[model samples]
Target: MTTTTELRVATDGLTKRYGGRAAVDGVSLTVRAGEVYGFLGPNGAGKTTTLRMLVGLVRPTAGTATVLGRDPGDPSACARIGVLIEGPGFYPYLSGRDNLRVLCRYRGLSDAAAESALERVGLRARAHDRFRGYSLGMKQRLGVAAAMLGDPDLLILDEPTNGLDPAGVAEMRSLITDLAADGHTVLLSSHMLDEVQDTCDRVGVIVAGSLVAESTVSELRGGTTIVVRATPYPRALAVARDVAGANRVAATDTGIRVDADAGVAPRLVRALVGAGIEVFDVHSSERSLEEAFFDMTRGSDSTGDDPEVSR
Candidate 1:
């Protein structure tokens, strides 16, 4: 549903070299408007460096990048992009509300902006709590609230859920969803594969400073598969192959896996039942993003990555 013109972030052959080694090498990716785009990679995979380039904190050594239709770091573009890279840094002694108010003054924004941001991130109830006293989740939410100060069109968050507990992560995920629903574009970078798989509409996987894959979670995982658990294993196998085609049917540790759609489940069950095989259960399955990610970047782990390059 997103057109080329709606792209909020686009890079072509973007590169950044630290001394002789390239932290990010010839990377090209896109972030569409109003979508939760995940920039996924492992630690030292150059995710942070790439984000720094996107937000103008660091310059790219080669190639080009456009943020919000303007060159990265352009004042006009920067005004429209809110960033929360590396995490929030507020005066520990200041109240959460006061911290935002300070940022408001520094940015020449009104105190009203601070109040609105607090309410947006559900921090208004405890807005008066000291920064050092707030829970980890609350601190992260306050960080997001700081970024939301101007109601910018794009939010560039780097591992917002880095050190949170389960409940904290859930809260951050909900906040992201709400931001996108309100027509904001979010470019979320994280090394956490499963979290990215759950939260992102589309993801670009970076490995060893190079982009290996970019696509929707389901697309990257490939097609649907029908998994059937049945008794009389041999009979069930034969029946499944006959019904779903031998090439598509493969035996798994627990059951038979058919590389077919859910529509084939009924026919498979029926065939097994008629063949005197007791069907225990039948369901559709898909390859997980984690499996696909490891498949694409298999050997990179053991080889290790450059320590000089940041995540």
Candidate 2:
């Protein structure tokens, strides 16, 4: 009997080049079982290209990857892969149910597969609605449902929430989260930090076709700036600087800011209070995933650094 490894996807030095331009350059990353993994990058950041290679829609120009412990090009492995990359094509005249039925037939899946897929995406009621009549959000949901036709072990979605409005975005987020909850391994790629931060268990950041960083959202927010409000601004500023062991301290309009971890909050409060400074409030401006992204990717062009920081 073959024992299944925990890694759902593993790629090492995965490179793809078009002409002389390197689209995906030496990206090494791993996605473990039963987690919603986020592949984040701006447009043309090679996120789509990387995903295309994984699903065997496009062959890798260089490097290697394994999906379900089999080569990506292996047809047997392809059967265990589900994709909603780009936007799915649906026959405009066919109802959603019929569209899914057609896909099921193509994949040689059963009618139960069609029904379960629609139900999973919460589109069972509208299963009979015409494909062309679907709203942008509905179209996205149907695409997801169609991808579930095979009930594959790994689901790879490229920019699944790209064009949706706020409500649609939230719906897509809910659907992705629910899939992960059902013990499905999902790999979703998007440019939206909020979507990934909300939906993913871990995120790998791509920039200029490089895997620049990979970590959980909380771990990405590693460098937090503590904001402290105390009477006697200068003295409080000195206390913050001393406590945080940081020179990147600045006086805000109402308080002082010091670059440090959230752990420094208590020490900051105690020091100010001990120094007879009236401590009013202390909070960490807590570096957001987006903020950390820019900070890490800043001057990436000049530095050409592929720093992988994980916890």
Instruction: Give the candidate number with the greatest lDDT.
Output: 1
Lowest lDDT sum, 10 consecutive residues, model 2, at: 302-311
Which segments of model 2 are wrong by more than 4 Å? 1-4, 246-254, 259-263, 298-311
* Model 2 error, position 6 (Å): 1.4
What lDDT tens digits, residue by residue, belong to model 2 across residues 177-211? 88788888999987788777778889998888888
List residue ranges in candidate 1 displaced over 4 A.
Answer: 132-136, 302-310
TM-score of each: 0.90, 0.87
Model 1 lDDT tens row, 1-311:
76668999999999988788777889999999999999887778888889989988888899999999998889998888888887689999999999999999988899999999898777898999899998877888888889888889999998888777887688788888988999999999976778878889999988878998889988999999988898889889999999989999899996899999888988888788888889888888888988988898777751235434456
Candidate-wise lDDT, in order = 0.87, 0.81
RMSD of 1: 2.4
